[model samples]
Target: MKTTSQSRMRMVPTITNETIIALIGLYCLAVVMGYGRFLFTATLPDIMTQLTLSTTVAGWLASVNYIGYFIGALIAMFVPQRTTWQTLMLWTAMSVITTMMLAIPSLPIMLWYLVRLLAGIASGIAMILSSTLVIQSFSLERRALLSTLHYAGIGVGISASAILTWWLLSLDYHFDVIWLIAGLSSLPLLWLLLGIRPDNAADANPQPRSIHQTYINFKRSLYEAISGNGKAISLLSTSYVLAGFGYITSTTFLPVMATNQLADTYAGLQIWLVVGVSIIIFNPVWGILAKRIGEINTLIGLTLLQALGMFSPLWFAGALGLYANAIIVGMTFAGMVSMTLNIIKNMNPVYSNLLIGLATLAYALGQFIGPLVTVALAGDNDNFDAGLLAAGIGLLMGLGLLLWFRQLPQKSV
Candidate 1:
């Protein structure tokens, strides 16, 4: 009886290394991507009011950050696979420093720009490296479902920041204080991250190679990876660019938009919270749906859905439309990211890191363009309607590309 009981107990699944890694990834993302990146979006209205900044200035700041992210993704593409873990730790520390710097008061605009730019670079590197580590680990273990948990960190971080902001505002806390508190909150997570080592030999010494040789090798590998599936890859990359452009305006400005429309500060935060919660709930659903309907088809359906969400505020009245938009956009954006990366990784597992970096580079360029174009279209009155419309159109264009991609030979994808 004892032997049978022990055998049954052994059969029960327990916490595995991949699961622990996934959880660590979740927290790392919550800090780097969530608090480090989106905290600005959550606190933007307060920052603008406190700093006496114009909409155009705010748009410029956002664009500058995306430019930094673009540069970071470019750098990540060239990062040696053997060094990804160590490099990720370095960038994550940078994220913490930049987040804390935002707490400084009365800084010049140039300083603000520099800080945000640095933060963006940190975010981009942390995002790519963390995802690369978590997904590759899970894929090796044949536990792909864990990737959803890893991605869920973004939503968790967003939700946590929104909640913190909402509470602080109720207490009449200044934007600087909010920044400080957010920064300090990440310390525990960072400590936890430090204690957990990646499965990779992150401390391994690298073989000396000339920069020129490294670049040549990278170029050759990238070329070889894309050569067989050039058409499909191109379509996917173009669509991802559109996805980045289409979603960012909403990601960056939704809280502000809601506050403007509702004339209630808390209402906007609530809406942002809704977005976070929706992401947490639905991101996993997307993975399961992809299994049932095929990833390409799932991408098509979600792209169309998000485009509709982008247009909802224009069609519907008041906060109702904003809420609808929040839920739909929130649910789909993270899923789109994970799904797109997963597809590319599966395309060539040997070069997944390079593929992911390339995709991120494309996405960051679109992000860099989004705010500038939106602000330009919005003009002096700060009317975002036209910009929102443009974002929807971009998503539709991306949807068209996905459709084209789907029509390509299945073996190529």
Candidate 2:
């Protein structure tokens, strides 16, 4: 017979443990993604002004970062054993250091490019590790909800940085000051990592695979994914590539585009703030909707919404279009990411993490291509309308693929 005191103590530790895990995952994303990844967008205009960057060169910088992201994803897929929470901590710390390095006023353009590229790699690893470990912490009954909380960290980080950027800019702070502040703010998250017990998760199954077995398994999965009913899954994976291209174009350039169109430096940051808010608010809702309507259908609907979001700036003018773009795109993108991962996991539970890394690799490749196309089309005018149009078309093509996928026999994926 258990006393009430013992029961209370047990309950308290369990709840405390759960909360701590969620917080670690959330702040890891906030530091790695919000600061490391999207911070470039918030600071790009300033970097361009200070460095005298041409549109073409800016595109190159973005591409190089995504290239690092691709390499990180590849490593995560092939060598998942390295993705411990300690590794996540190491990468998160590196992101802070590299982000601050960009504040060096005398840093060459090439150095800026290199630092951002390294930051991207750290961000990519942190993103994969945080999502993987956080999801594994919850049981199947609670996994979807917990997954929503985990990914929502990206939005939280984005919103916090956007607000901070806006506030600092209003006070006439230099971009370097902004970077320093961002770096310092991440220091507290490090303490949370101290409490992380990777083996404490309810579902922590560290399956060790030899390199030879991993290679053979990879080959077998690849062959199956490309043949027979697996063809639908293959096609689905391909759609993620286009999704990456479509989303990254707007994400990379939204602030620059907004500033130019509105003739207000802060307008873009404000819109980005809206986007962050929408992502935080809607991701959990999207998770619920996925459970209700089915992941495939939810993905199709979200993709269609995102396509329209990409085209909104081109379709309408003034604040109406900008806000619509932020809200629609913000609400859909993170949800689509979560749903796609869920679909992939359901398709292959045994190899889900590797498959996710594979899907992310495809997406990273598309991201690598996106900025080059945008810059190429923008030329000297700096007008991004044509680039945005191309992104919309790419998303529509992905939507078409999803429609075709829907018609296929639902037996496999």
Q: Highest lDDT: which candidate?
A: 1
Q: What TM-score does structure 1 among the candidates reach?
A: 0.93
| Candidate 1 lDDT over residue span 121-214, tens digit each | 9988888888887677675444457888899999998899899999999999977888799888888765555544443443455888998998
lDDT of each: 0.85, 0.79
Evaluate model 2: give its lDDT: 0.79
Off by over 4 Å in 1: 1-16, 139-142, 199-203
Q: Give TM per candidate.
A: 0.93, 0.88
Residue 25 accuracy (lDDT) in model 2: 81
